[model samples]
Target: MKFHMLHRVYLLAGVSYFATAPDVLADPVSLLATAIQGFLLSSTAIAATATGAIATIAANAIVIGGLAAVSLLGGRRGGAIKPSDAKSTFEAADSSVIEGIGRVRVGGMKAFGNTDGSTRWRLVARLQGPIDAIEAYYVGGREVVVDPDGSVTSPPWPKRSGGSWMKIEDKLGTGSETAWSALVTAFPSLWTSAHRVRGIAQSLVTYYNPGLTSGTYLKLYQAGVPDTEWLARASKIYDPRTGLTAWSDNGILACAHVLRRDPAFGFDGFDWDLIAASANKADVLVATKTGTEKRSRVSGMWAWESERGATMQQLMDSAGVVLRMTDAGKIWFDLIDDVPTSEIDFDPIDIVEYSWKSGPEAVERPNICRLEYYSPERNYDMAEIDLSGIAWARVQDEIDRYGPKYLDIKLPFCPSASQAQRIARRMFALSRADSGVMRTNMVGLAAWGRYYGQITEPDTGDIELVSLAAPEIDDEAGLVDIPFAIWPTLSAWNPAVDEADAPDEVPELGYTSDIPQPNAPTAMVQVVYPDTSREFRIGFSLTGTYDLSEANYRTYTGALPNGWTAMTEGTNFAYVAGDLEGVTVDCRVRIFNGEDGSPFSEILNGIVAIDNTAPTMPVASSGGIDAGTLNVSVHGTSLNMVAIRMRKRIYNDILGWGDWFDVVTYAGRPMQDLNFSDSAASQEVQWLLQCLTSNGTEGPGLVYHYTPPAP
Candidate 1:
């Protein structure tokens, strides 16, 4: 049997060994070579002899073959057995071709080869139990176990009689029951291995789920036992079928776990207790249960779900928290609106590059005429709020002008709509507020300086009032800007006062200083006639060199035909006369410097005229008539230059008089009598005349009739 195994090994190595006699040599080197050849020949002879000597081991031919093959490969590769080659040979050999089933001899085989008998048994034993155990276990039918050698086996059924049957009949039911008990004894170790395999499978399946991070696959692999309860929980947490909550919760838990585990994310200083307290105040749960906080109570749950590729930072951003690294290299998680205690300034020197855009595109102003907020705690589902009446009227006016814009924001921990609305409105106002960017290159102007307060440009005298948002800066780039709120300084003007004094004058003590002789007062005189009365008055506006109080004024030469007298010695003076119509008067002002004894001042002359009446209408008298023409005499007013207009029409005709024509020579002239010729036609001709005075007054009309002479 050993010989057969050695032959099989030789066949596996693809080589054959045939014993042959070596020729004897006299020389030493040739003798040495001949001896070595003789030794190999002897080894082959022994292998053949041993194969014929052990027929009982023939049934274990395959195992023998595997060992022989290991021996041959070891001999070729410097006398060391390759475990991989042995395993492959054992796995590939046909068990059916071998005659019997029993462990093959592996010890004391110096003639055949040096084989590791212990290692060979261990590999066989390691594979043997699972095969035996699986065969022993049973379900509806007896379970079958397939061996690595391609042999299948099943455990025997319980006997109906004898001791085994009696034992089975008394307590255990059948052989399958006994086998199952044995299998259960070894199930833990087996289940652990199976669980690890399942974890790998699950990770592969969920690799494409959104919000997956670098450590997600590791987490999935570490997930404990697979059971219905665990699966249900996993489905609730990660199943997209459950809607945004599941995916979001998964992402949140994933990020939370990552944050908790990261050494740089200073969870040591995080106030979990405070977060718990604040979360509990909501009366609804907000904080999610985490692996690190298993024992702590969670009052709420929050999910952050987005597209499949969303990053951990993006999820945290959606939660309205900022994740930043501190100067000490620790991570800080803060509310989006939290203001830093220190101020930050980013000057032009600190910025590398920057751009700004403002208009309808940067900020959308919506009308928002009405505001309503969801209120689950209130009696009503929603509560109405006033937007226009708020203090942010300027913001509202922008909204009103632009049109209504709607935004629904979720405030996770807010207890009531009132609170939520206040926060929402504040956030909205901040969002719509003015923002700008100023790039600078100053390194000391860190991001902290942006919130520090105002930054002033000393050179330009331009000041940025308040920082609206955080500054983005880092050591490498050394560039940043006070992003959001910026108000430029207003320009102003200053005035200077002149420094000077006035001189003083004194008057004589007892007697008033001799009144200085008054200069002639310039006078403007206008004659006005009152419609209510026939009286006329001269209106005068006067400017004098001396104070009017020190001067006495009087109307001088050429006052009206009547004895018109001046009423007062003031800058404005008037003289009244009842019968001054059609008269012109030369008026002058005489100013007395002081009392009656003072000499009169030089006269200031002005002219005033009154002509309140219009001229009388002209009278026309007919003269001798000639063929087709007639001569007539016309008389007009004698007070002033007079003009005449004449129109002709047939006597007793219903048609109105023709257009008037001016007596050109008599127009605006001082003539009272004028002769004119009019056309004499087949019927009688009538003449109508009206007169206008030089003062532009018009009088009533007069008519004259004449008959043309026969041709």
Candidate 2:
């Protein structure tokens, strides 16, 4: 149902009754639908979107074995991360590096360690550099503010037995670090001038305790306690455009560093000039909540160790970037942006044959993306975030009609909340708009420079946008079978300005231990039936003792929202009455006490009360000869409009094209008649006829061959 509706993989390792839960006594189908929203369920779900998903079997189900979170499509070292792979922080065991751009918190290797056996102890940490700068320090898993001179400010240091304090000496080394002269002076043989440690961010920590007993001194000195951890900005990378290195968190700059730095992980000894030029023009593109900011910039971070490809993917996912690999093995990347990057403007003649395919059903699609990630703001520990202000997404009436749906995902290497939110927003945008696949078969040179995945449908009169594809070729048949995902172009959405702050995750929405149902916010929904479409309007209408002003309603569509929006600072939520166009279906109001749902007032015009079935494929006429022209007839239950298009072919060569035209049907006709004229000079044509309801839903199309009689 849509008045106009509005709309990630999240990693929810132990997703405890996540998202919306329907009442236990509810119908089994409703219960299953609610369960499908929060978890990355198996393929078989409650219902399919295109068809009525009574029990749908999905094609894409997420795998979150461990990692309270890790990004989508999994990482490179063969497959996804498993439970056995979960461990303590990588800072303790791995040597960290910052590639591309962005700021990150890193732990370092102890290059030097010395203890005087009584009063003093010294240790040196070495970091990969020359880096941009050390921004902050995370000592004991907490970010601590520091002065320019390396003195801790916020958490005042605690003293030892002899009034001695810990202190740090930092060398913000851009390959110009000097030796520890004082350590050399105190113990010449142990610490020397050769320990300059140039080209690395170096830190020397000292602990001195003058008056301690033997046992106390040994315990304090031998303990594995560490000093301040370093959070530094990554150094500039080579921009093929500038012929120099510069500071940037740009996707191309990041991906380039991954590909050219070291022989072990880099794709060195190859020509990247073409890739670099593509980057110069395309790297700046980024995902936008507005769907208008084509040159929107994105950012990412890397502080953990992983396979080389995984690192590259994190950068791409963080920036909502699209990396296209060609059959020729050439690598190209672009942002999940609104801008059209394709070279050729398409014409219908390019499509020799085409068929429409439905994307994941609403049951399979998750509206809320519970994205888990590590945050630099939280001292490099795990954090979760989502997006709510994104426009033109699946924030439609479904969330209010069904229940909350969730797609739990993780960005293992992503550290910024804003970056994580961008990726989550992209998931929602693409899932809502790019769900259908157009299986287009063509035999032409029109797609010479265009990627197989970047093509759009040729017919302009359809209700779709630029189509997405996963490429396959029928080499023997001499056809490129490009199954295209119907992707709505951003510019077409004309997305409204969304300035609301994307709601941040607030300590698991206050649910801890055994979940107690919230004793408030029983909601009501008005199911409006217009001529063709169903519009559902919902809001919490202050019942019981729960104050309407203080209550925050987190409505679930089928999944969790990309981000959660609560009653922050008295935010005004828009409301609609339970009746539209003065028609009401007698039913029970929806109950959302916890994150669970109740039954809807089920009513269908001219159908059973509990029906949610879709009209099947329509039967169309084979273009029989009548009145000196070809006659076409389309049949369906709730018959709508007939979309007809034709093209001519002769001698095994396809010729000119005909744009799609819709024949709107009127009620009370036993059968509808479609008339075609000769304004465009119809010849022997391949006629494509499809059905579109007034609400703009489509069914499988029918094809026929027709020839016009001479006038």
Candidate 3:
């Protein structure tokens, strides 16, 4: 709750580009196919212009926006083009049935078939609802798509659901083809096919049922598929359980064919090669060759030694990578070195745990992990650690040690809480465990600058707003590099330029410094954008130090010359500016006890000095001792002018401050020039000879004079 003062001055005119945002958008040229067509006309132009990127990939991904007009309009058209066929029904004739509740059967069903005697039949049925409020419901079916090539062809048979569901079917010619078919239908909406549907069903079971693994689900698919059809030969499933999406290709034509269709899942499908060239694109396909050659390679061992007191290896060994651990032991891929190979693939995702350690010297180290391939994508993740399920003791300890360090910068304009959270969080690689951990409801941090303005912390009150001033032509006369000192609250910040004819009372973004305040605890801080009338938010948690409303008494004032004009003033603050040489300002501030209205006793009172006096002319210092020396130095009459003061800033790492020290106030000895043996031979002595003849009135100001120090 402590308040601190920060006075930053920015030179108005300088660089061609003003503010440099922390995030660098992804290669714009890389946005092709679905991404381009999806985000093109929406916020694409604005994002492109503002970020100066050609393609819309980075802009579309990071920028908060409404649905693209083209998409919305197309959706409307699609609604109009609503399939000529609406509802669909599936009928199969099977003999064995459990009539009372949900039934199970094995033979003679059109969609169901018995390939092997020991194989079991599974039935799955679903109900597809309306276009808008429609929801898909699984009805139930045992066998489907047997003799799929002969029996099922073209548009394929309608799934046991409403017509709203699109029907797609792919026949597997071999075991590999079955796998490939399953992969194609993994995500129903994204891809549709009988094999894919079967694969998705198995994936669903594996994810939801603890005892059921992907193999168990696959067994059900194998048992249900009719013997009349050919099995697939190649197919790789993209695991959705993990954050990363990696694909595998068996060197078989199926996998390669799918990839060759669109290398990066439609990324290269677009005609734009510039984007493909600019983007980070990679494809890895491993296969067994006819003959094996002996080779020696260096195995890489990346050891993350935790200065925070624990090693990643120990944590992983204990926790394991699976979401849930059971008595059967943790489920994770064991590192195997069966083949005489040199290099083992290492990924950051493979890391299991990290421990926090701190020292008396204020140093903190946490043993975390980095992916060998994508080192930039490090995660604080202890592979199997579900931070949500962590013990309270550990969580609290983390909260105490690190304060808000884990939280990313939350901008106000982001679309949703999730987007805001993601933006706020540093990428897993950039995450530092020692930094304070903050709880967030979602992933990306929202950048809603229009709502929130700059944040301020005054000396005697809770953190408040010091509305940033509308950029004006300073005497220096230059376009203000705004971010040099003041940062906007949001990324899509569109500030309105004030007009010369506009009334001062009107709150124009660029010209008026009108900062808004929060109305309620839940109400976000909203500010009218300078450029456009649209309002934006400035983000910050209001519950922290300002939990209560308490007034403080402070007798503080800045020492400024009288000639300067006071642009604005507040109950506890005021701003005045003028040409430094033309003003003679004196300002002082003192803190006092509010209850008694008396000066509060402290180590030292707050005082800022200002000198508007011009450099005075030097005088002839004839100490009458005529033999001692004629020290020609400026001897000022006023105490303030006696010591010419200037402010010097030094960076203080320990204190997290740029220490602004008063350079002139030091009680050190002054530099003296004497018309003696040494001074007589120097330029200083030559000045003195001229000064003695001119008598004080026509020469430089002698600020001060003193005797030589004891050598």
**TM-score for candidate 1:** 0.25
Tens digits of per-residue lDDT, candidate 2, 325-395, equal 33232345555554445444444655666666555566665666566655544445456543454443345
In order of appearance, the predictions have TM-scores of 0.25, 0.48, 0.18
lDDT of 3 by residue, 1-711 (tens): 211111111101111111221111111211110011111112212232443322222322222222222233332111100010111122433211100000101111123212123322222211100001100111112112212122221012222232211122332111122223332334344333423222111111011111235553443233433222111111222322332222221111111122222112232222223222211111121111222211110000111110100111111111111011111211111111111122111122321221222211212322221111100011111111112321210224544665322322212111112211222222221233221111111110221111113222222322221122221112233212111112212222111110011111221112122222222211111121112222111111122222112111112123311111111212222222222222222222122122111111111222223323332433333432122233322232221122322233333336543544433321101122333221212111111221111111212323222233333
Tell me model 1's lDDT, rounded to 2 decimals.
0.31
Scored by CA lDDT, what does every candidate get?
0.31, 0.41, 0.20
The weakest ten consecutive residues by lDDT in model 2 span 1-10
Candidate 3 versus truth, CA RMSD in Å, comes to 39.0
Ranking by TM-score: 2, 1, 3
Tens-place lDDT digits, model 1, residues 86-179: 1121222211111000111110000000113211010111110000011111111112122222222111111223111001100111111121
